[model samples]
Target: MGDGSLRRIAALARQDARLLARDPAPLIVRTLMPLLVMGFTQPLFRAALRAGDVPDANGAEQGVPGMAVVFLFLLVNVVGFAMFREHGWHTWDRLRAGPARSFELVAGHVLVALAAALAQLAVVLGVGGALSGLRVRGSWPALAVVGVPLALCVVMAGMALVALCRSISQLTVAANLLALLLAGLGGALTPLSVLPDWARPLAPGVPSYWAMRGFSTVVLDGGGVVDVLLPAAVLCGFAAGLTVVTLVFFRSAHPKLTWS
Candidate 1:
């Protein structure tokens, strides 16, 4: 990237971070709710571990990663709502009045969303370790194998959806439904092994599924960094595709929107 582009992205990302910092709602909702769910699901995870001779199994492994995945979907709203937020606040036109390119602006928001995802995942996983005795049986580098690519995919996919939404209510309904649906279908709500025979085939379509698998390998199967390379590559591919879609959708919609 050119220095000019880098400067634009950095400046805009700083602005986004400031704005998001002012609102604790996203942090509270995404962070607290998942922790609560993780705590609530501890027993089931314990039972599942106990019922089987699953190697290196623990409650946190069974629960924390899935909870983290589920909340990743819910947390995407912070990124998906970027454009609609300006519209609601009556600042869209003013933002468009700025000299920055639309790509720069959009890229900044995506970076912010990625930041949120990374923080949420780390925090959730950290708490799981601290409070729930979550263990990392594999290389720490393998953790990033899942987390980084998953964050990018989630944010890019969210930005793509943002282009389709005209208002917060529309985005809210769409995000909530999509998040819940993906969580359920991607094996975040439950392990794919336990799902019905027919449903397992569909899990591969979602990035979260690969993310869950990557985490599971490291946390449950005592996998090395190489073990998760495929899942991480798959997630990076999803992020790339989603990035293309996001840019195409935003470019197509920008001219018609009041903000762009």
Candidate 2:
């Protein structure tokens, strides 16, 4: 809360940003792959939506948002690995010994992750509109209602994984599994109505489901902020819960091995 804390957080954020800039493969892959997937799968989504009674659907309505959610979740690697690499390079201890408090360190890294997630989301949406014929039928504010919380949830989920996993391999496995599970189960891969009966019921429990719901309401249904309120709130709840888990479980003293 003090100036000193703010300074520390800013400094830490700058360092992490520099590192990310130096090695940008994760960001590029996460963003580019989704666009490629959307390109190849748009026709498929269009047909599927038509079969489901959305006669006007252009596939971008489904494909664009779906790919955004899936790949945004996959960006978890950007957050989880950033922390793991700090330990891998034997810099975590040095960081801990510095003047920055634990909260400041985490906050700084989180700021960077949050910015990256939002920027990626914006790029995907912009490019989606240009390349895939995606358009927002609803309010742009409503879109942010869905996107901001979704990004926060993803960042917290990544932090939670780092807090819980003991080694680099464990973090890698858990992060990947969580991303895929959340995406698939949340209807990012397909509409919830089309998912298996058992999976449909569980869709509400995952953040991506709400994200997709909000996107559908906005991009497909032409809904406004009021329509997306529930999905945004649910995403915020998930982010808050994950944040608590990360704060409680994360420790400077925890031994995070670089490898299995």
Candidate 3:
């Protein structure tokens, strides 16, 4: 990329960060909402597990681990909030018309989203440790290795949505609906084993499923770095595929129009 292009991308990132910081609602929803949900739901989920309404594979030990997956799914949805906000302000259109390349613009947003995801992940992990006594048997390095790329995939998925959405209202509705659906199907709301057999094959296709599986393996199951490889690869593929599809859609939508 040229120096001008690089600078434009940096400027776009700075602009996005400033805009996000200025909006208290988006900030709260993106950062604090997940933590709030985790705080409130943890008790109920624990109660459910104890009541035998929800079977625990590892007895009470699964509570915190299970909640970890929930927290991660929340983080993924939160990180996608920027796309909705950008659509509202038409900032994406403006940025695309500027010196920044599509990749650079996408990259900048992904970085911001990654940072938000990591920050929320830290809060969730800390709360799990303090309140629920969740354990992390895997190396911190391995956790970070899996986490960073997952965040990137999530952000790229958000950008793809932004490119495809026709309006802010549509974007908001779609993002929330997609988040809820993915969370439910990906074992964030319930364990994969509890899902019907027909739904089993579809789980691997959803990015959240791969993410929750990878995270649970490393953090809860004490799996090694190699164990996370498949899920991580799936996430990477999702990111790449979504990026290409979004670019194509964006280009086609923004094509020059002919006037009579």
Best by lDDT: 2
lDDT of prediction 1:
0.79
What TM-score does each of the candidates earn?
A: 0.91, 0.97, 0.78
TM-score-better candidate, 1 vs 2: 2
C-alpha displacement of 21 in model 3, angstroms? 2.3
Error of 2 at 53 (Å): 2.3
Q: Rate the local accuracy (lDDT) of all candidates.
A: 0.79, 0.89, 0.63
- Per-residue accuracy of model 2 over 126-179 as CA lDDT, tens digit each: 787679988778987898889999999999999999899998788778878998
TM-score for candidate 1, please give it: 0.91
Would you give me the overall lDDT of model 2? 0.89
Best candidate (score: TM-score):
2
- Decoy 2 TM-score against native: 0.97
Q: Which ten residues in a row are the worst by lDDT in model 2?
A: 251-260
Q: After superposing candidate 2, which stretches have Cα over 4 Å from the reference?
A: none
Arranged by lDDT, best first: 2, 1, 3
Per-residue lDDT for 81-162 in model 3, tens only?
Answer: 5655554455656766666676776667776776766666665556655665555667656666666666667666666766
In candidate 1, which residue pairs clash?
A: none
